[model samples]
Target: MTQSEFVNLVMPFKDKLYRLAKRLLVSTEEAEDATQEVLMKLWDKKKGIGSYRNVEAFAMTMTKNFCLDRLKSKQSGNLKLVHSNYADDRTSLQKEVELNDSLEWVGRIMEGLPEQQKLVLQLRDVEQYDYDEISEMLDMKPTAVRVALSRARKAVREQLIKKHSYGIQ
Candidate 1:
């Protein structure tokens, strides 16, 4: 791939990669450094990135390996907090605030999922990757992806419903 092609391929994935890194390593600073290192590696491989089919898959694998390597070398407790951005489409400030709260709850629910399910759900829902794409990326059967997504969606919905009911009291 050419320089421009490589940039186009990876530009859209920056935030997703950062989020994944942050969550996995549980540190803002470390996540940023990991993302930077990941991007730099990609930059070096632009000419040899080859097919786009495996680009995201390969990138995610790299992120996981990098985080695990760093974590293994370090003390490995909870990581420090990092600042983040949010979606901004709501018209009302109150609604936006409420949405933020709801998102936090949802994120908590996601964190509670088994690691495999959580990653599957994030790729399928948040990243809008289809089952085939997820299967290819994770080396899972397509049917397994479907089952995991079904369970994940049900879990998220159930958790949200329960949280809402608790709130109404």
Candidate 2:
């Protein structure tokens, strides 16, 4: 691929790649590095990239594997998972506070989930990927992806209810 073609192909989903890396690696620096690494790898394989049915899914799979490997490395000792999904720009102060609190609890709850469940949740729920796409990216059957996502959501709901009901952290 020419430089311009490569850029055009890769540019659209670059932020998505960064977000996925950040979601998994839990540090802005690490996520940046991971995104750069993935992009470099893709650039090197730019010729073959065209052969994939869905380059985005392939890239996502690469990012997921890369981040998981980084997490398993000894260098990951300092990494911690954290994320907030909601924004407060349009709400009243009280509503913003409550939203932030709820988002914080959701992030904490998500952090406690298993790695597979977390990835599934992030891809399906946060990233808004469909079941087939998630299955392709995650290397699982579509049904399995659905089951994992369902379980992840159920776990989050159960934890949120428990926390609110019993005032437990």
Q: Pick the candidate with the highest lDDT.
A: 2
lDDT by residue for model 2 over 44-97, one digit each (tens)? 998888799999999999999998898787345553322222222322446533
lDDT by residue (66-124, candidate 1, tens digit) is: 76677566635442212121222323446534654776667756766766677787788
Return the top candidate by TM-score. 2
Using all chains and alpha carbons, the TM-scores for the candidates as numbered come to 0.69, 0.81
Q: Return the lDDT, model 2, position 133.
A: 91
Q: lDDT values of the candidates? A: 0.73, 0.81
Ten-residue region with minimum lDDT total, candidate 2: 81-90
Residue 38 alpha-carbon offset, candidate 2, angstroms: 0.3
lDDT of 1: 0.73
